[model samples]
Target: MIRITKELSFPLENILFSFALKSEAADVFDGHNTLITGIGKVNAAYELSKAIQHKKPSLIVNLGSAGSNYFQKGDVICCSKFIQRDMDVRGLGFEQYETPLSNLPILLEYGFEMEGLQTGICGTGDNFEMGHNTRIYNVVDMEAYALAMIAMKENIPFLCLKYISDGADDNAADDWMIQVHKAAVAYGNILNLNKNNISI
Candidate 1:
């Protein structure tokens, strides 16, 4: 079975419509299933963790948009790892970036191969730092790391599929606005088609 969280629609325009599909399974072949959580951000992770505990689905897939410093627009990134870039305690008085805890190891152990489509660290922050901050992360997003961390704690498998919608610069927000439709289509179709092909 496959489980997709509500955060899946983050990069799409039809958020309400997509959210309507939450808790319901989008029937895919090979026992693959998809679920969505309408709640977003930190709430996304918190809610999704509860959903996963309730369902105990086989795999967790986080599909969304990512901004890049080095990536050009329209690039698809399959994250191998995630990082919490904004969990800075120094300002609050602490140091060290926190890595998300997840059941990714279970997925790997269960034969889910994530071997080099684009291996890089996905930096996470509460804010959308792409257009205004133009941060230099391989991939930047709001929820993946939190989701991963939750999955890790639960010992469930997790994976993130992201499409680069902006370059994480002054134009990042606008760039995403222009390419959002295309990004949504591509991401949805890819999820639809790769229902059983988990070989990375």
Candidate 2:
């Protein structure tokens, strides 16, 4: 859990910027308190839990790149709802996306909805989606669900912003490699515009 900003300042001091990878965030969020949680659900959950234990933040803002079949590339989406796409325990009489005996809902809807940004339902899974066919979620990522769950458990406000880097199809890998670098720029612009105006 590395803090990108050396000196914590006002407005952003209470806000924690969470990213799955450093490449997704780049250096655009240098002046803010950022946590590079690595990739996937386990890493994200562990790192964020450690960060919270060390210092509880008022808001946890997750910014990263994602693949989407519904959204176009270069679009910055605000994801207020999250679902674990890989959680399938239907054989045990549990609903799809439900954590068995956890009492958590199938869909976890908890995040700040940013004005002027397109809202999306983010599906988080361990594997990279190459052929997304589910209509339940419009966006697919590797970490947002775990991060959101932690925030929900801790009673911390959460905000998720995803940059559409690729379409979840055969061409996803190649497209993601090319467009992922631009995620930081798009996030920078969104945060800059909302930093002062938004409550979260």
Candidate 3:
């Protein structure tokens, strides 16, 4: 049970920037309060939880690389809705993507909507989506859902910005390797441009 304080004056100082890998962050977030939560939901949840315990942030901003079929490569998308793509328990009379007996909705909607940015429904899963059969989500990532969940539980404002590194196809691995390094630059530009305009 981490307590959040509303005394922070600067917006950037009160923001907790989260990433799944150091490669995704690069040197853009050099001196800021950034957390590299490794990969996947478990790591994302554990690392973010630990960080919040030390100091609760007013806002949790998740910046990462993601694969998408609907959006083009090199596009930066603002995601407000999240889904656990790997959660499937239809066999147990539970709805698809629903957490069994948890009372959580299949699509968890909570995040700041940035102006002039395209919004997307992000599907977070353990597996790297190469085929991407469903139209339910346009963006696919490995950790945003867990981070978003923690932020929701903590009553903290959350924002997720995903850079499209691949097209979620057979060439996704190669494309991701090439485009992932550019995510930091994209995020940096967006933040710098909107730093004064962003309310949360």
Candidate 4:
């Protein structure tokens, strides 16, 4: 009864490998479980929302890589709330990317069980935010906020779990390639423990 989605093949591939190694229910959705959607914050959101509607899972987990300021590579971030920081609706005027507050607390309550975990606002965008662009936020990624937005609208209990694959700077890409495997393992551990309800 858990549904998971990823924006790219790398993240998806890692996620699947993690699932295989960690969960007994890996074969539950053999064919229909994995949905291959190319990257893009918006596109992944739409496709994932549609998939959620179709699957109607009890829990929806979004697994991927992200850039962070305070976190080191391989750190896991279980977002208590996800937001679309790039959406400028005040001037044009509407909440373009708003996700519901799932009544979940915003602090690390299960740190003893899961190590190196942090809780903070995840700023989502359509592009990989790096360098000076990261000065305004702590962490950046392509899909979390949008996925959270859609999940809120669809009335699903969504959990945004992303592993820090890079720091927020020019060196991000290189860092990601180097740390993704370890990040994936950390993500799998987070999932296996079912820490979604533990909040931030």
Clash count of each predicted structure: 10, 0, 0, 1
> What TM-score does model 4 achieve against the real structure?
0.64
* Weakest lDDT window of 10 consecutive positions for candidate 1: 11-20
Estimate every model's Cα lDDT from 0 to 1. 0.55, 0.87, 0.88, 0.53
Candidate 1 structure quality by residue, lDDT tens digits, 5-109: 333222221111111122222332223344455434566676676667666655566666778877667776777576676764455434445323532321121
Query: What lDDT tens digits, residue by residue, belong to model 3 across residues 1-200?
Result: 11222343336777888999999888877777899999999999999999999978888989999999999999999999999999999999998899998888999999887776899999999999999989989999999999999999999888899999999999999999999999998988877723333333
Give residue 78's lDDT in candidate 2 (0 to 100): 90
Question: TM-scores of the models, in the given order?
Answer: 0.66, 0.90, 0.91, 0.64
lDDT of 2 by residue, 1-58 (tens): 2222234223567788899888987877766778999999999999999999887787
Q: Which stretches of candidate 1 lie over 4 Å from their true place?
A: 1-33, 38-40, 91-93, 96-116, 131-136, 188-200
Model 4 regions lying over 4 Å from their true place: 1-36, 89-116, 132-136, 193-200
**Residue 180, model 1, lDDT:** 56
Best by lDDT: 3
Tens-place lDDT digits, model 4, residues 7-73:
2111222221112111222333233244434456757766775676666654455666778877767
Best-to-worst lDDT order: 3, 2, 1, 4
